[model samples]
Target: MKVFKIVRVLFFISFFSFAQNEDYVKENYNKTETTITMRDGIKLFTVIYAPKDTSKEYPILLQRTPYSCQPYGEDAFRTKIAPNEFLMKEGNIVVYQDVRGRWMSEGVYDNMRAYIPNKKGKQIDEASDTYDSIDWLVKNIPNNNGNVGIWGISYPGFYATYSLLDSHPALKAVSPQASIGDFFFDDFHHNGAYLLSYWRVTPLFGHEKTQPTAKPWFNFPDLGTEDQYQFFLDAGPLSNLDAYYKEDNVFWQQLKDHPNYDDFWKSRGIIQHLKNVKPAVMFVGGFFDAEDLYGPFNSYQAVEKNSSNYNTIVFGPWSHGDWARNSERQSIGNVYFGDSISHTYQKNIETTFFNNFLKNNTQVTVKLPEAYMFDTGLNQWEQYEQWPPKNTEKKSYFLQNNQRLNTHAEKSFTFEEFVSDPKKPVPYSEDIKMVFTPRKYMTDDQRFAARRPDVLVFETPILTEDITMAGPILAKLKVSTTGTDADWVVKVIDVFPSDAADFPETQAYLKMDNYFMMVRSEVMRGRFRNSFSIPEAFIPNEKTAVSIKLQDVNHTFKKGHKIQVQVQSTWFPLIDLNPQTFVPNIFEAKATDFKKQTHRVYNDSSIEFTVLKKK
Candidate 1:
């Protein structure tokens, strides 16, 4: 009865305002702020907006973001328009809700996604809350047409995905934009490998628990947001961290709980349960999206293969958040596409997906699906029927004499050895930013790593013809480790012009840090490579074979350019200081736990990429 009353009151206001279909402005909408009580008595705060001129009820467009919910249509830190463009002009009731345990919302924020599973199955999640939230929104919100949609980027994107598992029937659309589907694959954990630098800096964003309570958290300038001052101050030899740790920092604890791909992570994975998906979905990602590239693609593939759901994917040469709005083309590390690719795409590509599905926008008739790629040189979007074209064939170039990547094999090759000491890891200066710093895996660069002695480089012969590679790149080689634990980093490089005046020669190369993270950063724990669930020690003098899966790449190595792969044992502080000991937790290792490890490259067991070609 209360819901009906709310609907009637809104209908009367909506009917009177429908007299004019004028251009919509920010203030022309009505908003309601509420601390909604869930079925479980959990109070989740939400900000709702409705089109003033609601002739017919509008579909509800919801975004569950931890980034906080501000007034709809107001200038947000994102600076992008909410109610998005298609929603604003086309008009829909937009709702932004803060997840439990963060901001003004109630309940312990589990960082929602990462949780160690219980042997007896005890766990609380965002999906249940999302269901509760949706149940209330559909029944309570006035002028809501039952149809609903949700979307977000990065951390918030994780919420969007979490909401879909046991979704409300009203949720007809959802776009998990650049979300990290598997925490271990990206984010805190990279390919089971630890992303220490990113982890070290992330807790700063969680409310003020990690802050100095005595000193207002706001007063202290944040590292990335403010300047480098805080970063240096926080990590300097004098900083004490216990004063900062908070309950909301579940992600930090999460790293400790799920040491392997056990039930803990398995329970959080929804890609496997993506059956009978009732919503029209849009999985958004950036072609160059470093952190969550695996998420969107992996999720899309799972949805496509696991279930017969209606879905679409849109990817441009973008970063973690760039896909959300129009902005500068380049992100960090001086990585730039030709121009403002985001602006050219913002004319309602994303908003259209939500509007067309949620509001049933008639303006959107035909839609595109599958992975879309934006060619760097061409500066255009191309739709692929599938990733790693089924028609393509595999081409392997072996690591040969010296640093030359060769189709021609070198029969006699000696073993190469280098000491991988975590304590004195490479610094993050010049081109070696990845060596010591943690960046949201997006930008691509190799100039700084091309000359590192620790990194063994291999190059393919100068090509008379162009080679087209459209698939996941893999590094298959004979590998061995002298110590209890070791890390092998591999990178794929696009050998461009060598500062020649002829063509302004410059090409992008994947560094060892990225390669290792992309391919097999999934933790081997060294002791568990033979099995993530089982434990075993490595044979010190044994030569073993390890295949590192380079993150997927789509490229047409143009003429005169070369393809190269670099191998190194340690990515250092960029990744955690892997103490060279295969202990339960390397964090507890002693100073003497560090050891220098050796690796070898051989002709019989050479480094090669499994390529796809037009078979």
Candidate 2:
């Protein structure tokens, strides 16, 4: 019996190679469903899949999305169609659409819409609906290749950064992963506060659909407790959670009618109109992207200071769209980060950034790095020709007199108190899980916020060699506040070495011995310090200077590890509690305007850090 016929021909060759990879897009694509139109005639709703291989021609890619581009009709295909799965098994036409008013599109949804600049007639936006959906998909699809490539992840990465503004000369290339450049500092405000963990994602962008649908018009709001910090501290203030969203959420009434940074958040800030940009951009994100890390580092430094074009940026050790997932041990919660880092960023940097600009006789020459990043305390992937890498060194530290963090300063002036208690605030996470915006508290373990006495810890002493740091952290608070509005937060930590070894992906009642990790953190809103369009309040005790910034980070601190620096003032419910009184609207405060006050920090409170210089 010839060994049962060679195990029945190796189980019929592994069941026909798992049915040709689960019906490779219904065995080599062809799924249509159109609409397109745009430039104000509206339409949108697309879908396409193409590729039946009429011997060649392909490249289209696109994405758009307001989330739903579901498996709707036209023989419902999509068990994965591009943007990974190695660009959905190479051979693109792909497309998805449904943007303008979202789902089956027709126009009306505006959250983050504002980008018009020189549009004549029907004044459309998302860069003229991505330049009229890449001019009707390179003039009506088919086995074509007029070349176009756009990607998305997170609000379709903000419409792949609005197709690099007024673009579409066959679009060329764009990435924008984990993007959202600014809903006031990337995803529901940061420097001006208010991110109660993105308040149940405001009914999927403040509901209001009436037609053209395939489903999910918007629902998520049954917050009846999973202890989301005692359901947002018993829903106190934020106008008692606006009765779980009253007047049918139009972006939660434009977040209670623009809580500042006016011009309705500087006209939906697409990174100050990412100037002259025209395709060939990358800008992916996640340095623990607890929601857009201020939109891919201010949209890759606003297209590297107003685009020369072919700009780039990667940043890994992901969290929000973990490099558009495929997963194989690339952890983030208990920190594991390696092994197929999102399938080596989809076979070497997103299929060589869309096969070196939408393949047409392509061999993919791969020359990326304008900053790839991902150190997260040395986990790996680095490369940079520029990106806070002008051989750094800004340094600063300070906050001294016992609890040190030195680099010298604090000759005499000393202060250090804390009280803060907006009814006992300060728990950004010890697994507060009710997440929508938590992302493992972006590399958590701050020793439960440095044993919170309303946090203010500040160490340094042990690291004798490896420090690294690399870019953007400012902080600079010489404070005082007996309640007149406050929020501060600023983290940074690294600590580790108490014989640190717990990684089997840690967390089993944790133990990386002296772990404290949390590489970077932010949250400002001390009445927007001087102005996020005029906020100024803390005059109660007056030391006032403030500053904050805190976003970029490459991280190393290794030698014996220590670095620290906590400083806090209620990061509870992750922003939105700062009612130390000043009210023109702390989203309509008044629970006795949240009292408990005290707060101080001076010792010439410093911080700065760009460091990185040992080549």
Best-fitting candidate, scored by lDDT: 2
lDDT of 2: 0.80
TM-score to native of every candidate shown: 0.80, 0.38
lDDT of 1 at 514: 25
Q: Candidate 2: deviation at residue 141, Å?
A: 4.6
Error of 2 at 174 (Å): 5.7
Clashing pairs for model 2 are 153-157
Candidate 1 overall Cα lDDT vs. reference? 0.57
Per-residue alpha-carbon lDDT of model 2 for 283-302, expressed as tens digits? Answer: 88888888788888888888
Model 1 lDDT per residue over 1-615, tens place: 242232223211111121123434445577677777766677888877777786779888777765456433333212223524445566777777877765667765554454322212334567776777888889998878888888777766777776667667888778888776776666666555665556444453443333111121221122343222234224422112323444455554555656676777766665665655656677877656556777877777777776666677777766556644445443434444555566555454666676666766433455754566665423457667766456666667777657777665556755665566564454322332321133433333454555666667777767687676666666666656776666666666666645322211122443322221111122233554566555455567577766666656666566766677767765544555555666665534555666666656554445444354543
Per-model lDDT: 0.57, 0.80
